[model samples]
Target: MSTHALGSAKLVLAQNVVHIDPAPAVFEAMKEGWARQQSARFLRAASITPRLRLIERFGEFTGQYPWQWTPAEGEAFIAHLRGGAKPIQMSTARTYEVTIGLFIEYLMDSRYGWTEVCGERFGEGPQAVFHEGNSVLHTIEYEGDPRRRPLDYDEVQALFDAADARPAKIRGQGRKGVLAALRDAAVLKTIYAYGTRRTESSRVDLVDFRRNRKAPRFGNYGSLMVRFGKASKGAPAKRRTVLTVPEMDWVVGVLQEWLSEIRPHFAPGRHPALWVTERVGRLSPRSINEAFVNARQAAGLDEDLDLHCLRHSYITHLTEFGYPARFVQEQVGHSHASTTAIYMGVSNEYRNKLLEASMKARLGEDWE
Candidate 1:
């Protein structure tokens, strides 16, 4: 008969496995190995800890985790979870179920270690166990419409003003104050002004700005070439987007006076990217989020000011100013008119006024 060891202390036979006293280091290694496997599959790092905790907690009573679970044990886990007065959300439960299923599936793949645990020990494959676990998880039900609470113009403006008013505090008398307000204001402004996706907002390069003599020079009016996005693998490359003159001028002026001044000092390698690392590298999405957090806290703004909100606000601002939906869609880099139609629904007052004007003109009131 074939024999194997589950861990340093546990010996597996065709029929039974014997356990010996195992050090915590062995379990920790197992946990790290599991984390690595999941991470390799593109699971976010933020999710790894929670999934591990769930498995550990379940293991405390069951002797083994979901990966080692049988159909009866899977059912027992469900009962244990539902026994609590406070029911967990179906979405949350589903997430855990998926994690557990993946673990079992990984073990059964034969490539991992299935040759050691097949029909001789467990009658079914890993996939069979995963299906059983999924069936139990699916019984959980949640009832509610998706919640969406979009911000109003005044609320958005308040956030902007609050960002502008943030104070800087640091140690020592001569120490430069934190430019929290300015930074926050710039972040919020850029989000709304550009209608940028979060990834795009964080990735925008300084080279996107260029001189345009044909645009209006008075007031805050200048054009900017926005790096919209990459083309498909075989598609032709697209030209950079030309933003509204007013928005471009505002962004350029602030960046030139502030970011430009500070760019050289920390940029040891003099990286050409607009958002560079202190030692000269590209600014990561994490850095952008940190800046957002600082600005939000300083301005006393609510948690609703997410990066995607800027894209919504961009569409809203354009529609409010009487720009055509098609024109707005093009500027925002959306290919669908239906996607831009959401902005049209935001202001019924504008639509009503337009309707009244059309009616009056049709009735000959303006013809005279």
Candidate 2:
């Protein structure tokens, strides 16, 4: 009688097994849940694909189905990653842990019916494997690599000089990319002047530039209406208008020249993109990054300096230029003052200048 019962259980297992080789139905159901998220607009295809890949990788690492997974298995997988020859960074490990945790949560959710399906099929069900104790914490305020810190004032000047010289050098050689080089220079300057992210810079439209009442000299280039500011998860794009400051007012003439002379040469038609490409379309973020890379190399700057460094430099420079912390935060579209502080990489010289002025005011000329 016992032998017959064992045979019956084996037949049930075999029938239930569908692509995972152990339990294909569960995998199919999990995929359907992911598809539901996509349909609900909770995630874009670009975001969904990578997360699905991560789930599959976790499943392969555990060598078991999701229902059979445990906290021990999840811990072991993270340990394996840390012990690998090319171990992942803490941020990357945290992302992996979060993705796995979310997947497990999906399976355990009663609304999806994964729990009941697993319990009936395997006499077990999924549970949360990652918890607060084992997960990484946001301990540090500034987690970005030190190598990618903001450029100093001299370095910013050198980078801009290199960008400006590119068009001149190529034009002297009778090269065909003079217009492209000019576009790159203007793009970099606009990003720095406006403290815009690469995507924001790339997405700028001619009509986005508005007149500032206080800065009438800048005309239509007095402020920028950024329609594509960074958004929080599952939220629409945030919008902010970055006003042109007195110190960076030189950008007004640069933009004027680009709009009147250089940009017209691109023949962008009525596309309205501020930065036009050789193809007469809006500049892409990838091209913006490439432009920065080329300029950094030409300037003999640090290899770690990326296009985002330009924004960091802008934030730090504004702080040094006597702008209040709250003002800087608003200019960069950061929701918190702490976020703006993280972007600041102020120079020692500026700090010293501040100290000197403060000492003179407090000592009443007694401070030498």
Candidate 3:
């Protein structure tokens, strides 16, 4: 059995170790305890794997029962992490913190007699000691930034035009290449227009298109609900957004055609995931990134542009069009209004307008 350790905590794996079973008690406990405690859907998804591995590694490292470690031992572990072995990315390191905190809380509750070797926050207890011990360690500092960006109307149109005009492979060796390019370009458009994350966009099935079948009228509206495996347990509610008519039309026309015709020819799968690779699996985030990179090069656009940038661009577009920040936040499923405000900054046109107004006010009617 494979196992690994982080700091004082250890993960133990056993041959045929049925770790998480669907027992009623286990299911109910996890529902009320582990999953319910986590706020973000994504965070819950990440906790399960690391904790299971931790259990496996414990036995492997010490050749003893899994739950054995002193507070000092735990602190030493943190130092080890900070030192070199696990120089994890900030995003990934945060998951480790969340997992450890939840595991400790579970142990303390007495619902399960899981032993506790340490108290206080993981970062403060063992992790801090290690951090302080290492003078050369680089601390992570948060510079607040918003998460979504979408391209402007003109830029998106230009990119589409560029993709359409990409030189054919020696003038007709294969239309498959041309069609694939067209399909990917449309995929890019759908993601930006719909404000979907890459995973959500990738797993989107052909059935998702039928959600538009009964299109909503003036007094009626339709929602596109994205469902997936929840990190925590229970009925996973859909993260849904309503679509405007124009948005619906673009998705229905361009995106639907790719699914109906092109995607099946290139990539086939059990579920009709909207995007696919030549290999027949749903496109991964890496694939989406590579596609974006190639598209940018072909379009002669700035190299800095990527998939998520389109999300930010969308927020900016709405802000400039005079939509209220609150409305924009809701449209993009932003939990915090401030998060939306960060990406959708005051546009240059708006800033200049403010300056002009200030000048006019200062100089009376003399300043034009």
Candidate 4:
């Protein structure tokens, strides 16, 4: 029969293949085969390992090998996941179902000969256990937590104010967190000003800053190369340059003060990271998140607001400021204008101004 290097048929014939517990041998081979197949497609280990673990979890829950699996077991396992104290989100449940479906499809493909191998050893062959009827439907494009919306203009300023006050507040209480607090304040303002994701905020280097010839006053802080922009699945991080706009140009001073004065206290020698921790050259995404939480609590903003809301706020404010949709999309590095539009939560006042401007164009300036 047809066989590939990591195919079940080829693996079963190996000298080092498991000799006892033939069922377990075939099962392990199937997983290894699937992992190798995914590797060939250029997926990283971080992207592939969770699928293997989920398959193992499913196998354990069903108490059956691939050849012995049925739709009932797959449905039952998903149902079990939806129950218990730690029930998963619908998005997570859908992902699990999809992973199971992919794993089953891989095993049953004739070229791999897994079906033939399983039939010879276990008297059965793998079959599709998941289908449209049992799978979770993902109708919502934005399935993120509903609470994570954009901060209002005032809330954004208040958050910045709180982060700024943290250094003095800690120093007043006689602590050594003054420098770290200042760094975090700068980091938070930068995130809102640039509309960056958490990792993008932490991953920037000092050299990423660039000057704008047209806006020479900003002086080497006019824009930044976001080297760690969000990526497509299995792809490298995308890069984009976010320009300094007039509205949020205050971020220029914040960054200038941070790089020159406060950050040196951290003694980050030879470290290129824009945001650094005491022990590590680069700050972590989690620490960025914690900074947002502490600032939000200090500001007494809503508890539901998280770090991502800064990006949301940036998108919203840019829309209210009359930036073209396409320009905003490029600034934020969204591949689609539709994705950019979704993040924009323009104010009703802006809508009224648009209506008035349209009327004035047709009805004349004296019409009002």
Deviating ranges (above 4 Å) for candidate 3? 1-47, 54-91, 116-162, 165-176, 206-237, 245-253, 256-286, 297-305, 354-368
Candidate 2: where is the Cα deviation over 4 Å? 1-22, 38-41, 80-86, 172-174
Question: Who wins the lDDT comparison?
Answer: 4
* Local error of candidate 1 at residue 34 (angstroms): 9.5
Clashes of each: 1, 0, 26, 0
lDDT per residue for candidate 1 within 43-154, as digits (tens), equals: 6666677878876765675686333557566556656776799766556555656666665565555544543444433453333344642454454233222232334577
Candidate RMSDs in order:
8.1, 6.4, 9.3, 2.3
- For each candidate, what TM-score against the reference? 0.56, 0.89, 0.60, 0.93
Give lDDT for model 3.
0.54
Task: Give the number of colliding residue pairs in candidate 3.
Answer: 26
How far off is residue 18 in model 3, in Å?
20
**Per-residue alpha-carbon lDDT of model 4 for 64-113, expressed as tens digits?**
99899999998999899899999888888888989989999988888788
- Taking the tens digit of each residue's C-alpha lDDT, what string does model 2 give over 7-70? 1223233343454444765565566565564446666666778888888888898888888888
Better by lDDT, candidate 3 or 2? 2
60 in model 4: Cα distance from truth in Å? 2.2
